[model samples]
Target: MQIIVVSRHLKSARTITIMPRHVLGALAVFFVLVFLSSAFFSFISLHFRLPIVENILLSVQQQETRQTRDYITNNLNLMATRLGELQGRLLQLDTLGDRVSDLAGIKPKAADVAEKPGQGGPFLPAPLSATELQQEIERLATAVDRQADDLAFMEFKLLEKRVEERLMPTTLPVKNAVFGSGFGYRNDPFAGLRSRHDGLDFAAPTGTPVVAAADGVVLTASYHQEFGNMIDVDHGDGLVSRYAHLSAMDVVESQIVRRGDKIGAVGTTGRSTGPHLHFEVRMLGVPQNPATFLKRGEDFARLQRR
Candidate 1:
């Protein structure tokens, strides 16, 4: 580039040439001035508390603060909903525990009664803060744990009851047999005089199946002179059952037997005059009324039916 200057007092014209370097230098100086001016104005604005700049900065900060508050509120709301669901599940566990306790016939302990309080009211909606919600969730979780423990205890008790029932003499020895003389003082069929009958009699056809009344180990299966072919089963807890005048013996001594297992057949092998079963129950080697145990069995069966 070129520039010419005309002068009349000196009677000469001056010509100036512009190169690429000169153009570059001018651009650099212009940028430097612009940068310094920007810096100066920014410093002045901050030092003098300019309303326009301050307002812009304050607006940006307020927007960020609002966004943060909204995020926290949304998270807390979701957490509250989850806590409510957990509480509902805890209530269901409590109800289940109650049912199991009833089925197992478990009486509530003092601790259980104290833990559960009667609580009922009209629904009142209220918003909870984060801290309160957390505390409530913790309390509900503890309740759920307690309910689980209670249910486990009930289950154990139920199992124990079932085992005891199985071990007890609950089944009738002879099915569909005619009842003869019962346990008590009665006229002796052989002596023709009043005597105490230590057992009950069930008259049945010869070779009629005679089953065990309970679960036990056969202690004796041998022929006796007066009782004829007899079998004694030793149930646990010092209880024993005797079956007299058996026609055929199906079980052996020291053999385990379950309730209703066929142990022999009915017959009149002893001092009796007709085919019948002499069933006796004894505790600690002492005679007991067989009717009492049979009645208990009947009551248990009736309850099961109900």
Candidate 2:
């Protein structure tokens, strides 16, 4: 290369010398240094076989794959556990379903219609498919609903039973202080010993108020041959009670009466007994143990204690 120099201030001229060889030598050294550095760096990079950017990308990809696998594994395990727990709860619900059905008087098959189970093994089989699981869940929900309804019905029944029990007599028909005759076959006080007595007798002072043994309606209230005056009260549920040997009647026929209501006065008008009341309990016109109905209250109390 050749170069020319010029200066604007020319008061004194100065000459500068230039050498092509020195310039070429310097350029050669520069080329050699660049080649050596490139080779060294190339050797180091190829020997290790990865650049900083590539290594960073590779590490990031590895972490992502590992995290993805872990996430998938954990989620699958959690889903399996949840499905297992749901299956167990569903089993319990099925058992509860049967119990509730029984309580509600719902037969497995009624009116010639029966339920058909899905295609599956026994209830204790392996985990079900998604469709089968969905069906099971639906069945479980239905079972829960049925159980709830059954529980409500049972509560209502219990309340009804309580009301009925409360309305029952469960007390001694005649006063405890005075009872003329006990239950069982006995000679009629009015008739001879050959006659059989249907019910017990209550001996009391004349005009003593005779109360109803239980809540009922007066069925019959008129005179009779063997018994001078009698009142037949028909309680609900096929229960009928009789009050005989009354001096005067206070309630009329077909009149409603409550338990322990004054229905008549005890007297010896029928056969040949002193002032007394003859009481009898009958079910559908059949004679029953009067003492049983009279002790219901006490029996209930004992049961509650138990």
Candidate 3:
């Protein structure tokens, strides 16, 4: 584009040439000037705290503050709900600990007293602040840890009790057998003289199944001149059990056996008057009353049935 300037003072007309690039450069410079002016005015208004500017700034700050407050309140509410759930779970663990303590025959700790019933008087509501809510959550967490420890101890005690019961000679040797002679002094059937009978007798038919009274390793499975086809089991802790006068032996020496495992069959072998099983319990080589252990076994079985 071209533009002619008319001037009477000039000897000739002056001609100016305009291009698209010049128009574009002018537009860019105009935009820069406008932006600088606007920034300068904004700085002055803020520094002087103009009424309109101050009101607008205050409104924006208030909105941000409200959003932050709402966020915090929601978080606190969530924490409080979680704290209540943890308390309920702790109560359940306490009840389970009590039941397990009974089964394990362990006395409850002094701190494990029963919880008091709920109390009520007024319905006044007081909201918890952030600090109070945090403290409560921490306290509840500590209580949960304590309850977990108590439960763990109770579980260990229960397991120990079960192990002891398994090792003791408490199961009946011959099932459905009639009780014959008792332990202690009695008349010898063959000699007809008073003699100390070291074991209890169970009368059953020949070939009736005879089982182990406890878990143990077989120490001897051989014939004794007096007991005849006898089996001795070592039940650890210096306790041993003997099952004598068997028609057949099913286990061998050094074999492991669990309670109620079949070890032999009933038979009246050497020095016996009839088909019967001679059961004896010995601790450290001294004879013990087998009846006591058998009675305990019966009680344990009854509890299991329940």
Count of backbone clashes for each model? 0, 1, 0
User: Which regions of candidate 2 are displaced past 4 Å?
Assistant: 1-140, 163-169, 299-306
- Residue pairs with colliding backbones in model 1 are none
Task: Report lDDT per candidate.
Answer: 0.88, 0.72, 0.90
Q: Write the per-residue lDDT of candidate 2 for residues 1-306, one digit (tens) a residue.
A: 445556778655556666888888989999999999999977777688867846876899999999999996776666566666766766676577567656655565473246666786567757565566556656766755665665666657667776676456665554543655667777655555755566667677888888887777899999988778999988778888888888999999999988778888888877745777888888888888776776665432232110
* lDDT tens readout by residue for model 3, 1-306: 999998999999999999999999999999999999999989999999899999999999999999999999899989989889988988898788778878878888565576878998989999888889889889989988988998888888888888889989999998878777888999989888999998989888999999999999999999999899999999999999999999999999999999999999999887899999999999999999998888887742432210
RMSD of each: 9.8, 15.7, 6.5
Overall local distance difference test of candidate 1:
0.88
Superposed by TM-score, candidate 1 places the C-alpha of residue 127 at a distance from the truth, in angstroms, of 2.1
Candidate 2 lDDT score at position 119: 89
Clashes of 3: 0
Model 1 residue 80 distance off true place after TM-score fit, in angstroms: 3.1
lDDT of 1 by residue, 65-100 (tens): 999999989989888887988888888987888788
List the candidates ranked by lDDT, beginning with the highest: 3, 1, 2
- Rank order by TM-score, top first? 3, 1, 2
Query: Who wins the TM-score comparison?
Result: 3
